[model samples]
Target: MNEVQTIDELVISFENHLRSLQRSRFTIRQYWQTWKPLKIFISANNIEFFDITVGKQFIKSKLGAYEYANLNQMQRRLVNTVDALSVFQQTGKIHFGSAPLRRNPPKVFTGEIGILMEGYINFRKTTFGLAKSTANNNIRSLYTLFLFLEDKGVQKIDDISEVYILFFIKNLNPSTLSVNHSTLGVVKGFLKYAYEEKVFSTDWSKIIQRTNYKGQPKLPSFFSTDEIKSILNSIDRSNSSGKRDYAMILLAIKLGMRVSDIAGLKFEDIDWDKHVLTFTQFKTKKSITLPLLPEIGNAIIDYLKYARAVSDESHCFLQQLSPYKKVTAEDVSRVARFYIHRSGISLKERKHGAHALRHSFASELLGNKTSLPVISEALGHGHTSSTMFYLRIDINQLRQCALDVSLVPSTFYQQKGGFVS
Candidate 1:
């Protein structure tokens, strides 16, 4: 590796690399500012290579002088710099440690288990043609399993017993059915693969029972109509960020578009003349088209014409700050949360993310007696069953399904108070 002659050169190269990756200019500037102090410390000490010892010394020196806030900020920046340097030195590639999915498992699992995990991930991708997100989840699940094994001092895959598997299952959050089911599903899939590959003598997959979680159809948490209105009103449409957020929230509430789809929305997806919006569902991969309500269309137009940052990128929503890349799903959620918080609407038993807006949309439609199939189509649900859960919250519809107790014999009702013949 070519040694960085000067910290200035390294900073320049890192800044350029960040720009190449389309990192926001604000982020790049922050990184640069953070590195400046480190540069001074390194140059003063004549540190040749940035290593853990240098990092420790830098922290130790600054911890006493810097204020709490400044010190916290410096620590984060230093860690980011170290990560960037390490990646560059090892792979000859510039990575900002932004992609969690691309990260490898803990170093302890780098032996036999790691090889098997890699092979299993490849098998899932090539054999099953699973989505990148799904494959990533599977790999992460195996990593968790191996991490647990390492913690318990079991190194080899052959040494893994049913007791270890049961212990792992027991450790999962029992209240969270989805997490338990998904984790167990991935582990079992890996075990089956291992058995087929002769890594295990017996089919341990068969021994690991599926999670027996027959959970009730829980009502989807959503804001009330007034709360939704308050959230929308809370956004300061006078600014670019507010305008963008207002449009994104409308898309979620009016159309029930998933956060992912809203983040991935492009200019071409909307036809103003036709008053239609179309996009492929991120989760289901199904193409869906919906009528562009005047309210939603107007919000989007205000954002596009007045507020959206000028960028060559085609994504409908761009970050307010420089680099101005497309907004991510997490960004969409944050926007929702910010407005919801600003609105001062206290949510006790409901989610406050962008998805709550989606649930609100579904609840509104169901309240208006919209057919399940129509609501399903509107929400871009791949199956009507996916939409059925929303019905659990439709009290009016549920009331309609209730049996008319008034028709029952008086003897049947009065028998509890006094025995009636």
Candidate 2:
């Protein structure tokens, strides 16, 4: 899209969109007629782009003291048009004839600080090619600093310094070193952007740098062999949903497929002849093929034959209920959680998601003295380091690592009240 768009251009595009939606000729004409007032307003003000802020002002000027839901037909038409244009610009989607959308534009910024915040977010997205979610995370980290500057009467970005930076860092709630490091990186990057743009004079990016975090990650959750069996048994398997879920659980426990990979399973990803399954791993984007265990293949066959939803979607798993949508990664995880709870397993301090099943699968292999490299390959881990996370759950291996007591002083063990005297 062009960096700058005129009002007329947007309206023309919106008209094409309305036709694509298969709106009736008369309905499209009605929407087109409503666009005139907005066009006139944008022209009079010389707006280069029709943003939500301008849209709100247009509604106030045209409607002139009107209730939201209580608007007359003429007022409603104009408000909906503005709402549609606003939605089109922000999301590239039409929301025609929706008052609630016009009333509530997402997160409007009013002051200089808010304006700067908006710029930072836009720059981060455009320059770094960050996804919307990643950009939101950067905002989450930097918003506190923005507020701190405001509270300190530091209106100009020029006032930011080592002292203010230090103070802001001090007030943050203590978190893991990793979390703290991520937050610091965000602050430093924002400062770099500000300096390069001449919004702030100081080059404060040098104030913070990334460092390796040495702490061990907490042990991952896994079920015992019995607990895994119990979870599998909890499913009734009498109905379609039960049958569908049983197949899903087997994929996790038996193959150690990630929830995403399992939910995204396609019929073509399986080889009925060779007894193998192949699919691209979602997180790593690397393709992996695993031997399709006869039990897992059979379970999948049972689901496809009896219980699977009749969806046109190529994905193998689908919701049991109407609409019969393809199951999402969340859907699969929720299935795991549901049966884990029903199995009457103690979930205290243990993750009960599909991922825990993956952990259990690895731990089971480790218990059987499966080599780490072999287990790593079965888990489709790109590196053994990733597979090593499951090693902490092997209590016997950890016991072997326990320090030998041969070097300890004999006096330390014999010490008592009599020895002290």
Candidate 3:
């Protein structure tokens, strides 16, 4: 909270804040060691106030590279430390334990079309009751559409036409059918909104049709049980952060809980007496319960007993450092990817995300001959139809539909080779 303007002074203040938060001495030392080099770099470069530009320069000078993906674990941690310092100085906000990992460019639109974009976003939120994350996604899609229109010399929603829509569709050049399907849904959704408001002369919504997800649904990435075991085993249970992450990963792998639901879990959601974990699903808003196996229960209790930050937060988990509060879904994914990488599993062909674990959990159930309705309920999906996609990866069941060529030879093969009976 100190309004320290200079990088040197701010670093001292930030360190003091961490100490007050009672962050482990080891973590504090790691941060201190990282900041020491940054201080020397800034001092040598004759820099006064610290910023990301200076931080990047320092990182490049030290590591001889600027690309984040190219950095090793220790080097990335160095970047995170420097980035955390930059954020602390600029925003006066300590992001608690870890530094900010992802930063997206600000979406900018400056015209009447921009105004309508804002109006449409607000309308969707108020009228349709869209969640914040959903609204943000819609805004990103609409931003792309409006950016194209603005380039085409359009200024209002009234200017949106079938021609403009066609150009937009053609310009997308999406890599996959699923991406194309989602892009069209955004266009159609916006068109419907514009037509209902009488902003567009033609009902362009009719001109565009979205693919039926039910007919051609996107297949989710799933992992084998052995792969999941590897990911879980990668976690070091001695640290507080590791304990929290271990528990969170179990929720995703064993319970099929979404990132949002895991991050938003409250203490009240746990029924210790009944050994049940109950919470409302964020995407569907339906309350459901899962049995709290001893392994998961033990993990959570270990975190609570020795790892959970001291705070009045109602959420089951908290940021391990000062200003302890709920974490974002992105934070959960980062943790997931970190361990997934450490586990050394070859997931380059598949998505390395927590959702894959959710898919894996569903597939495991399918392999166990769990019924579709039961899996649907267990997954907190609104319908069994939504859970049917798991069948694609149910190789055991799919084999039942295949004919054994060895057991019965076809007539064509008999004619071609003169097969003996």
Candidate 4:
């Protein structure tokens, strides 16, 4: 094979490799599209051979040039593209790691403590069958605890004391209620495991005070009917991107599918003759079959027939650009936000993303006098309580359910005169 001399050649080679791997057209297109900026930057700066160092410098230079929303997206895309390129240059094949951890592992998780943490993570996965995200979270919490233990001059797992655990809790950021709760729960579990395994003679977990962080439930954000209509109408359906986005928004509002489910949708998931969409939900891992609304079906058909890029990948949705691949949940959110921004709809403290569409779907059903259980089923929620949050936004229904306080008679004593019943 000829030596890959330019970024264009490298991209072409990578695109072919992705195609061979049956990667979605959208994925290939997005990867290539993101690489275009780096290609340009390299040409302008006379930089040859793209690597981590050059990628960082390029990112640093372009930090403030883009809008806040696009800046993070661009940075992530660029970093991922550069990393892929670096790997491909070394192996002459496309290989990437799993999703990056939300927070970097603390320094203390490097030595003996690290080994213990790894064992705990494996135990969480194999023994308890916890999800990958949950296991990673537990690992993160343990890492934090280990960092605290290190600071206290405590060397091993056996040396852990209640005072050190209490000190860790005391030093936790007060504003981070969610983090503190998760960390404390994970620490408790760790202590229990250590005790059972005979690593610690005493189980200190039982003594660690629980962080009382039962925050008041806030109302979920949702768009009104008019707002949803306005946002949907804002999409310029004349273009390929418009058609794809319109279909995605319709799925969110009509079917109440999560962004991940939408992004992961495949051709086989849709039953055209039966007029049903069936797929496993991303988060809940439950198979759900939703009636395919005629409008949604038609929108999808229009995109698939005319707008969708040609690719062997089975995913229904693909990026319109070159090297097309399956869209991500983040991509779905960006599409929603793009239209919401253009439509001039004020989210008003509600989440301003595709999830908001789901919220709106439940709210609409509730407004139409739909039962909570039915609404929960439609939303693919495992429990009705998961759907209860929507009730907080249903003002009319709440009013109807409100109890008459005046019916309860209260005996009172007159202030200046005499006792009155």
Candidate 5:
């Protein structure tokens, strides 16, 4: 019999309706944000009772300022809000949807794309044992494809036909440049995962074909020997900050440790008498050991003796500035990038963060004839195949491994034919 008291109260009621419908947190949040602008318009006009004529006037006025995209989104929110209000009015909770308009059919999208992404996350967790960050990236890749499909007027899970998927992959226009083979792989992988999980009716993956437009595999960029030396030389070791940066770079390049793992290392992880630095990799969750190279040992000793911030925490790396908390992955990468610029190198080339140094280290070792298994162990790669990507970079090693062939017979045959002259 009584209407909602205030705008805030009305919003709360709407939010509660959404929650009761079992909508996702993301959807509920979007709905709330979308409805907020309308509330603002209502309050501004002093037309407060969920009136349709006033709503239409407010939307018409927006046509002057709001672009097509904004208008479409607002319309969608309006539709959902009106629908919810109608439900509430039916229950005698509020007078709602007094203004009636023909509603458009919900657009079709390959919404099963979400199911595929969830499948990838589950697969990475149960099968590959990937770290949270890596698993997250695979999900993001699949999500991006759905966004592309949504832009192309395909919306809803059931709308994703084989033709829809193939056209999306192979026949992308220049403006829709985001869709590529890597994303195609994501779509492909998601479909396979769905089939395996029995989420698809007919193993939709079998019909999904690849266009085979492979991207050029790039060598991971790293500081060359001279660049590394230049960076080290640029540091004023007398300063505490310089000493810590020097030490961090040494660990990054020499030990091939990821910034995340390096930042998480504790003072206790180092064994002085045993001459080893032992720590579990944060990304891989595997324990690894490095023979404390005298240079690395000296760097750590210098940093701890002078540069390291004294703290109750035992992490080897600590924030240089305030709080004296643990260094983050971004912090480690930032320092490395700063030194790179200070070294007077062009930032124009593919800029490398701290992990590039890890890639650099792997490359260096593989170039020096270290076996793939050894490099994998050093890099804390759970699989040797993962480390095998470095082979693509070590061309010299590949050349040297070419079986020795005598050129003498060929030369003599050429001379015997007298063609050499």
Candidate 6:
């Protein structure tokens, strides 16, 4: 049989394997999707799985086509192909497959970081049960670090010295990218974790200290109470999508959840009787339970009962169009952006996107004199320092405590050249 027929057989056999493993229908479909490209790429090249060198060559050729941003996705698909080949080999489903992909573990220098990344990826997949975007983010960060190390001529975990980290930090431009303190913190955390775990003995933390410059702190762009009212008013909730959009926007504002968390929400995540919503945070690898406030619960209930589309998909949010599927992270951002524009907000502030609603929630809480720890927990942040960022944006609360005084005192008015001048 030709390549197409061979691929079909492979897919059939893989589906059987997946079914045997008790994989969900959605996941089985994703596996087929991941496999199709590899089969097509191989067929076009007139190669069989037994020719491991050809597969390796094809992977290398395609590597250049993917830019830095897309390499992780391409790599994942390639990895999956390797996994499928392994399954075929073990099950006697295909005789020509060699499973050339070694699945080399990751570390700091000697490809150990790849192993480090895989640990995080597996944790996200199994423990936290994060959605694809979050797992992708955590994986991407580790991959980027590996790429950085490769560029620096550090090929093993032991090679990652304090000097190398210092150089990386010093060379990073925080202003243009707007990723100064946050990037530093991520790197510091990773290194510290690695060091303390004895994955690497080097004290990279001492060299890659947090910058004292403070850089330009980003003021979290959140809607003021009045602005929130105006934005909500702009939503035309008579239509189905309007109702759904309104519900989503309201949910974020009221609960202080990330857009990723909202998009990944399922029906089972919410508890009506207990007035609670529970889910695992993808970023921090922690399970969280939040009390479903009356307003949020009511909004979601209304949407599910009236506005939500009928679909087999378990996700709470779905696309408005036919063959409706789960709403993506991009969809969340786009919907929020559209309304932000409609509300006559500045374009500069629109970059905050759906996340601004969460920030708005935190700001409002801080304004109400809520403790930082409380706000941090509500926002699912691992540290209070992260939530403290919103405290600066609570200008209304600050105004209440400020001592109002005339700038020009009577004593200063008498001496024109003394103080006023």
Candidate 1: regions farther than 4 A off: 1-109, 126-133, 170-178, 214-218, 390-421
Could you give candidate 5's per-residue lDDT for residues 1-421 as a string of tens digits? 2354455666677677667867699977776765677778878888756644444555445432111222354554665564455445335343334323223223222445555566566776899788877665565556656655665666665676777666655543333223345455666777787778776665667766766553336656766777778777877889888888888888998888888877888989999999998998888788999888999999989999998887888898888887889988888999988887787865466656877778778878866777666777888888765676644545566554344566675566666456663
| Candidate 3 Cα errors over 4 Å, as ranges | 1-104, 108-111, 174-177, 211-219, 390-421
- TM-score between model 2 and native: 0.59
Error of 4 at 348 (Å): 3.4
- Residues 343-410 of candidate 6 have per-residue lDDT tens digits of 87555644558878887888788778776667778888777655555455355654543445768667
Q: After superposition, how far is residue 128 of candidate 3 from its true place, in Å?
A: 3.1
Q: Which candidate should be chosen as best, given TM-score against the real structure?
A: 4
TM-score between candidate 4 and the true structure: 0.67
The regions of model 6 sitting more than 4 angstroms off are 1-210, 213-216, 285-298, 346-352, 371-374, 381-384, 393-421
lDDT of 6: 0.68
User: Which ranges in model 4 have alpha carbons more than 4 Å from their true place?
Assistant: 1-108, 127-133, 389-421
lDDT digits (tens) for residues 210-298 of candidate 2: 66764456787899989999999999888888888999999999989999899999989999999999998876668899989998998
lDDT of 6 at 5: 34
The C-alpha TM-scores of every prediction are 0.65, 0.59, 0.65, 0.67, 0.61, 0.54
Which is the better candidate, 1 or 4, if ranked by TM-score?
A: 4
lDDT tens readout by residue for model 3, 222-241: 88988999999999999999
- Give lDDT for model 5: 0.68
Sort all candidates by TM-score, best to worst: 4, 3, 1, 5, 2, 6
Model 5 pairs whose backbones collide? 108-154, 108-155, 109-154, 109-155, 109-156, 111-157
List, residue by residue over 1-421, the lDDT tens digit for candidate 1: 4454355665566677777889997888777666778888998998876644465467546532121222244454665565565455445467744622123324334778778888888888888678667876786677778767776778887888889887877765444566557778888999999999999998889866866765455667888899988998898988888889999999999999888999999989999899998887787677999999999999999999999877899999999888998999999999888898899999887678888888889888877777777887898877777677654645567554344466777668767556775
- Which runs of model 5 end up more than 4 angstroms from their true locations? 1-120, 148-156, 170-179, 210-216, 345-352, 382-385, 394-396, 399-421
